[model samples]
Target: MGREYRCRIQGGPDRDAIRQLREGIRLDGQVSRFERIRHQGGRGANRWYEVVVCEGRYREIRRMWSAVGCRVNRLIRTRYGDLVLPRSLKAGQLRELNRAEVKALLRSVDVSHSGRRSSASSA
Candidate 1:
């Protein structure tokens, strides 16, 4: 769940461009859908759309938009799966957690093999 991503509003002024970008990504990447977000920038009169992708590859989305001559000015990863950077954590600061917290994470995984083993033993 530590996957990285590049997020952007593809294409220029035409509002429909966002829709096109969404469709293109689905077709090219073979994904069914991606979550869309809207935000108001400090200097802007209109709203902006942000696209989210799970797979992280540097500038992957930006390069895709650049293929059509569109520029992506803002790119930031706001979330990484279940882990969200704490608001208190600044740019260069870091937080170190104990080993128990790390091992607890593995308990969260739902492996299908466990279910199969239980069923076979009960038979």
Candidate 2:
């Protein structure tokens, strides 16, 4: 599933630089999708981005931005596929997903029922 991010970066990265970063992600064969939504704040430094990749590659987003010469000051994952981080869930707090929610999440990521059952059973 893809994720949306609001990132605070140090340098003002132009469109060309952002394109280069996208290319880098593609070259690495890691990212399935990469998009820069917009840059706000002074000098267009802070950016909003959306990316789709195989699971467990969230950290790579920071690395890719850093490799392109932008230091990420803040990175907030606002969405993961159909799951949005609830405003009520404060940092360090956890929320358990109900059965329907869990099923939807698994469907979003294309996980088979057997896979889900096996994982659940193991847990």
Candidate 3:
């Protein structure tokens, strides 16, 4: 139902690998590494692969696979800490914080539009 593959480089994965993967998917859906880069076990052992999914709807990554005759099987989100939506924030739901919290947040922002004149002006 699915395919899985791993690529172990000599120094582990890096931004270039990630970029190549993204570009490959964007252009042709095929995912692979640079020829010069070495992988563990070599050949079938280290080479990446594709998968065939039965589902109709696919995600952003899956859409890229359409160009390469391969389907993404395993996807690990590495930036969930910064982007993942918290359950506390609900759709169409807006809540206000306490006065102290509001003040703290506003204190950081430079609101020159407050229109408040300086306390000490020319005599």
Model 1, runs deviating above 4 Å: 1-13, 26-34, 42-48, 67-69, 87-94, 97-123
Question: What TM-scores do the predictions have?
Answer: 0.51, 0.67, 0.25
The full ranking of all candidates by lDDT, starting with the best, is 2, 1, 3
Per-residue lDDT of candidate 1, residues 50-88 (tens digit): 556655455656665564456766665555554455657
lDDT of 3 by residue, 14-60 (tens): 45554454444343353432222223333432334322222223354
Lowest-lDDT window of 10 residues in candidate 1?
108-117
lDDT of 2 by residue, 1-123 (tens): 666776777786777777776555543565533544455555454554444444436477677777677778877767777888886777688889889888898777667777754454345
* Candidates ranked by TM-score: 2, 1, 3
Give lDDT for model 2.
0.65
Question: Which candidate ranks first by TM-score, i.e. highest?
Answer: 2
Candidate 2: stretches off by over 4 Å: 26-37, 40-58, 112-123
Quote model 1's TM-score.
0.51
Which residue pairs in candidate 1 collide? Answer: 4-56
Best by lDDT: 2
lDDT of 1 at 51: 54
lDDT of 3: 0.36
